[model samples]
Target: MSKRGNRLRNQGKRGSRRAAAARDGNDNGSGKRGARSGERSRIGRFVRRVIVLGVAVVLLAAIFLAFAVGFAARSIPSYYQLQASAVGQTILVRARDGSEIVELGPSFGEWLDYEEIPDTMVDAMVAVEDRRFRSHFGIDFWRTGGAILEGMTGSRERVGGTSTITQQLARNLFLSSNRTFDRKAREAVLAMALEWRFSKEQILELYLNKVYFGGGAYGIDSASRKFFSHPATDLSVAEAAIIAGLVKAPSRYSPTADVQAAVDRAQVVLRLMREQGYITAREANVDVDTVELKQQSGQNSVRYFTDWALPQLDILLPETSAPIEVWTTLDVGMQRAASAAIESNTPANAQGALVSLDRDGAVLALVGGTDYVETNFNRATAAMRQPGSSWKLFVYLAALEAGYTPDDRVVDTPVTIDGWSPRNSSGRNVGETNLRTAFAYSINTVAAQLGNEVGFGTVASMARRFGVSSPISTFPSMVLGSSEVRLIEMTEAFAAVSAGGMAVEPYGILKVETAAGENLYRHEAARETQLVPDYVAAGITDLLQAAVQTGTGRAANIGRPVAGKTGTTSSNKDGWFVGFSSGITTGVWMGRDDAAAVPGLQGGRAPAQAFAAYMRYAVKDRPVEEFDTDLDLPEWRLEPDDEALFGDPDEYYYIDEDGNLIEPGRRDPMDDSFDVEGERPGGREGNRNGSGEPPPAVSEDFLERATGGPVRAPDPPAVPPRQRPRETLDVPPAPSANRQRDGGSGQDQLIY
Candidate 1:
């Protein structure tokens, strides 16, 4: 082949090979490009499917959130509706002359509007409870987020709560305080609703008006009045802070519960107020010492009287919601006197009670315990204790009604009946004595012999007739006051004797009326029924006068013609003195609530002293009048011979050379050994030297000489003193016997 031909052929073959190579390279390149494009398409499709799925999930979440928010919003209540509900009213108890004594019912004190509340109080509440109250719409998202972050971080310090003032108001007014998520969601929704319905000031005003402060105070005004004795508008910055801080826990921060805790909480509130720019640091600096917190009044002062009178309200105005005024017969002066008497007389660990009544049975004064705030036990009317020697009044009255005279002869020697032996309080029995001498000396043996002769049933009936409502046992011990009786009932019975034998029922509430002055009930003076003959009552009065003048009740004398009896029970568990003046009958009792024996306590000591102290004030302005006595009885007949009655006349009575009694149980002023300023053996007014101590034995001749007459022999065999069948008599003693003695035996003997 020619070179050109060979070159062309080679070139053709080479060009064909190159073209084939190019074609192969193009095929390979196109295949590689197609494979890359297929992979890119697959990746783009996957990305597109993922983006669509994410968008769908977001849309579903948005729809669910909208549904939940809508449900929560629907649960909100109308704020205006809640404001229209009725609130409870306070009940007022007033003195007889219209002075306010105490308040009853659910909420105490009056309610006030928002304008009446101080601005400091509002600022304090906002700063301490919700710092972002003004900026938030019921709930603060920023605060909520911070709290959530804090919880997630496990921070120790409490993260600020997210509830705004409006939120708190909503919860307080319309929602339950449940801590469930559902309740929280409802609270948030209700807060928003409240914000939408009311302005910021209106919402705050509602919150202040409805928030509970401690001490039964429901609103700011009530709380201010209860704690400071003033209106809410008059609250100082410190006071406002103190009250505002109570919202967290009223009882826990109550000043009455712990003043220091309340003060500490106030300090926190003040610090917050300063931090929030509500107050300056200087203004926030409060001296807790200068805070004059008002002491609790009404409830603490007259709890006993009010407790007793409260039960009567149900009967006065039963099932009624209206406020009422109860008029009580309590005399503030006498009540103060009684309270002072008990406080000054009783030991710190001991309890005492006093009840004073007018002749008509009007309860003038009543002291149940030392401090009513410490305890509400009404010891005066509720406590039932043995009367001890005070019970002898009935026994003597029964004997007198059984035709026994005060001059009748009775043996003071030990006597036995039904396996029971009775001895004189002196331990040594007086051989023979007249009834008057035995009665004056409080001889147990003589009293027992007389009680046996008259019968226990007779004494029990006499006590009932004299106004003793408690059960009276038909036992010989009843004559010695073994039966229990209430102080009030005993006082009433004594008042009956003072009222010339007329039965008197003690009453405190004089009238009950509505707040509008319409009378619900008015006390009418009940006609007194004669419980005993006037002569009989006068006789007992005479005897009791002698008792005070020379016997166990000498300590209770008020420098007037007073009649009373001293009673000291077994183990000194109870010490009592029930006395009566012309106008008042008062009973004083000192003892332990647990019935534990009070050391060194005797009826003639503290009890009689307290009685004298109280009566001196109780009868201050009243005219002193002498107790009525039976005119038929001889004036000096009841006076026993001191030498005959008490073994040593010098020990019991001071007699002049003329043989006339000078001072009973005391040294005569004329005696050279008598030191006027020196402490006497029986120092108290009503107490005698041997008042509660064992008596000394007297010779039989001394007894005859003391009686001012010869001792008559025992009645003949026609009626054996012990064998004579006793008859029960319900009448009190005759005036002759009652007026002749004021007698009670020693600690060892039970004599009245």
Candidate 2:
């Protein structure tokens, strides 16, 4: 205010102002101190909370570790128990002559002490699998942390594998292969248990002796013998490296699966070994070419037979864990021949299976697939494909039993039953012919008529009596071979015919015994009861022989008294040839697994060719046998009698170029133009003479007369192979609305 009221009065004013200024400065300093004090208090509270949280997290982790350890301790088995069950008893399967067929089940070669395992192998496994195996007690904390981090960030190459040898050993010995949280926890706990219970060398020994090495080899000893045909003691560095490399993925890196891949994997293992200072650089530089695998027969197909026979052994010796020897009925030579036939004749993108049975129903040979390594499905006994016209065996047998002869007259004209129409492969149906002619020709209409007349129940009974184990459909289409059946059963049925009407159960194992030579089970040869009358068998054999001589099955003729049938399904989905020659009944099937059509496949082509090829070799050593059953036979006729059927001289039949009987002089342009060798025109020349060409096409006018309406043959719809819905699907699959394309039958006639 008043500028200090002048100098004199200013003395008093100045004194007051200085006092106020000093008080103000003191107040400002106190406020700053209060703010600093509050900040220190807040920091102290934050520090205390952080300390409590850290303690809580540590406590929870401790609790979890303790619980995991307790659970693992309770579940872990004794080391001795693990060793005993690690590899089951080895199953030694021998052929009929007592020659070794294969060693199946858990095949452990020989147990070796920890010192016996090669140090190079131990080092390679440890270096590639775990870097700090000796330093880590059980879990490598550094790698585990990295694995966790990678998993959380979704960057782990694969999540949840403990990158340590001990963990892998724990999994191999006592854990399932599921990658769940519980499994991971148990794996970690068991890993720690293993590390604590056994020394590193002991753990390594167990790992080497328990790990799978593919090709059914378990343990290092077994793997060495399987891959190198040598004992583990003799495994070279390269061989050891290859065997050790299989620890990661036995199937993917099997020497038999891909030798180059195995060598490459072994090279990686060697480099890891050298990097970890387990071997010198020179020792790790072995040439891949030097790693020669044991020479094995190209026919690994025997594995299929062994795989099939192994299960049967259990039936003979139930629940017994002792090592047993299974003497099978397998003829090694015939098995090889069957494998060669299948490998040579199976079409690309298609699979083939064959089953051969001796007169006593002993399985002579079985070819499950063209390449057993590619697929071990055992289609001969497992695949349920439609038997096509091959199913007519049951229908014809039923007819023969019902007082009908192969020479009896049958009609093949276009006919419908209960809204189902089955067309012949050649589209045109011969009007009237004997059962033998229809049988030889594989006429669908005639077979369907016989199945209906004999009653579907009776036909099914005949199939059952012949050892057809699968469900038989009673649908109208079933008469046309719509029911699915196993190839083995079909072969067994044919074997029954070959055995002169005895019921036969297809058997592979002749005897079972302990490895110590104690008899466990021996097949007692009993006289088989007759399932079909002698006349019926004789009639079926006559029909079958005629079929091979001059019918769809002409390609299967082996120059002897061979009796067989050719079968093809709609859309060419399946091709089958089942026959008997020289007391051996063999059935062959060719088809795609997905039931997709193969454009040109036919039963008379590849299937019959394969049959003929195998049979020629199969019967070469055996005496030529005739199918004379000492039963009365009827006269065999090839052509239908139009004069007897219609009493019309104008409708006299004339033989066309492709083996069809046409009216008078009507001819197709496609006739006489077949490019097959040994073909003769103007008569039954193509399929009838084994030319493998389909019958001549039917005219549109003939189709109109057959169906009472103009018919167009459209592409057949794809029908999935049927499986039994309940225990069995006796109801037939819905027949296609349009005419079915010729199954593999070679004839162009629609089947269903």
Candidate 3:
């Protein structure tokens, strides 16, 4: 191609080559211009792309901020609920004398306004908890940035020191103390919400009022009272510092647990306050010895009483968020006496419960157990125990209501009802005697016969009428107090008797008042309804008086007129004594919680002694008053008759060395003449005389007639004396001369 120009007619085109050079110059210039234009176009396209990317990034950031705000708003609670959380109120239970028994629910001190809080307290709180609390809206961006930086660089597992005062308040009011990402997000949102709805001062007030202090105290007010025995208005600078320090670790810095540790923590708070200009340097130097602490009273025995009465408030008043003051019917004095008596008299291996009621059915004193601290099970109001022979009160009451008086004649021989044979405690029949005598002697056979005479259903009904709310089956054993019942119910039943047939529902609470002194509940006067006819009650009272005056209940005597019943369960598992005197009724019970038998346990022993001891203090101030025995009924004076009167009228009853009833002409078994046939006596034929016709064989229907039920067959061969079970009558005592006149030697001794 070079040659093309070479040969191009070398010589011939000298003029043509000059023209081509001009054209080439023009084309080259145009090409350079085009290249420059393409470069400028590429630069413009890159600028446009960069502008679009910037716009998209800004939009994404705005969307993220919107989503975060919406999520936080959704987790916020209503304003009313937030305010309600601040009024955590507790109930204060007071005795009849207005002395504090116990406080139920979380310990809460009196409510106070923001202005009521001491300035030093507020300043110390702000200095130690959050120095920049006043400046931040809800979150501290500066602190948050520091926390994030530290978390990334430091060895800490998680970010911390990010929560401001507002944030802490939000957590206390609405959020849990869970260190989770979601929780932190919610807490931040709630803090912002609080800041929006409440002012700075209002937020501070809520925080101070809702925060927890150590030792079961809540709020600054409670802390003040619990630590200093004064109101929040009287908070000293040192005290304020000590309380403020507790917000970090309450139990570790509790003034009650360790005063030195609390004071050391408070020193840190004081230094922080000084650094923040909240206090002067001189003011920050608080003397540790000046921090006088007043701890709450140690756990009290009266806690048992309050625990029992706490549930009753729900029935007595409407639910409320305000504080309550419960005025109970408990007599502080009686309660102490009852506690002492039970503690002194209760066996070491056994527990005791006591209940005392006024004629109006007001519970004056109740001891659920010997030591409430060991166990809090309320035996008086909750334990279900077999009432034992005390149940005979209902059986005899049914009989008396069935037109049978105390003077009604009854036999005290071994009796069987529905295959259940019961013998006198003495293991020997007293033969024939009036109902009064039989009851005073605690004759189990007479009680069984009386229960059969008045249907078991009737006996149960009588018990229910007397205030035994426990379920009572119609089984014949119920007549002997086999049913389980609460001690409160039994005592209430006796209170009804003391009230002259008026039905009684025992009550412990008298009134409930609000912290503002408004009446939330006031017990209305109980309506008096007839549970039993007055005559029947009087007749029952007669039997009870006779029992206490000269019978098994003699141990319960308080040197005054008293009426009561004694009950000893089988195997000595339970012993009970319930009595009334000076218009006050009380019941005492002793037993093991496992129902384990206590050797030598009897109603006439420990139970009776406790009842007497308590009653002595209970009625010490009341005037001595006798029971109204004027029922205008027929006289029941005893007189020697031709049947089996072998001694003086007053000496017809006989008792052996063990204070158990013995048959006439049965002298001391150790005497040589005790078994002499026909020895100066008018004994029945074949009855220890060994001289007349043998006793007739028992008829097939005899057991059925005696038990008020059908008998499958005649009695089996007589059981050997040693093989048959003996129910020795657990009687207290009687005069010894009565037995001496019959045949026993003159020696008074009581079998435990």
Strongest candidate by lDDT: 2
Give candidate 2's TM-score. 0.64
* Decreasing TM-score order of the candidates: 2, 1, 3
Ranking by lDDT: 2, 3, 1
Q: Clashing pairs in model 2? A: 425-749, 426-749, 427-749, 569-743
Q: Write the per-residue lDDT of candidate 2 for residues 273-387, one digit (tens) a residue.
A: 8887888999988896687798766657887887787777656676887888889999999998999999899899999999998888888899998887667789998999999
Cα lDDT, model 3, residue 453: 60
- lDDT, candidate 3, equals 0.77
* TM-score, candidate number 3: 0.56
Mark the regions of model 1 whose C-alpha exceeds 4 Å error after superposition: 1-89, 97-216, 224-303, 416-425, 631-752
Per-model tally of clashing residue pairs: 19, 4, 3
Cα distance off (Å), candidate 2, residue 695: 54
Off by over 4 Å in 3: 1-87, 108-216, 219-298, 633-752
**Candidate number with the higher TM-score (2 or 3):** 2
- Leading candidate by TM-score: 2
List candidate 2 segments past 4 Å from native: 1-86, 105-120, 138-156, 167-197, 218-243, 258-297, 343-351, 417-420, 454-465, 471-475, 525-535, 570-573, 591-601, 616-752
Q: Among all windows of ten consecutive residues in candidate 2, which has the lowest summed lDDT?
A: 720-729
Clash pairs detected, candidate 3: 425-728, 425-729, 426-729
For candidate 1, lDDT tens digit of each residue in 283-388? 9887865788998653444668777776876776657767777889888777888888898998658999999998888888888888886667899989888888
How far out, in Å, is residue 31 in model 2?
32
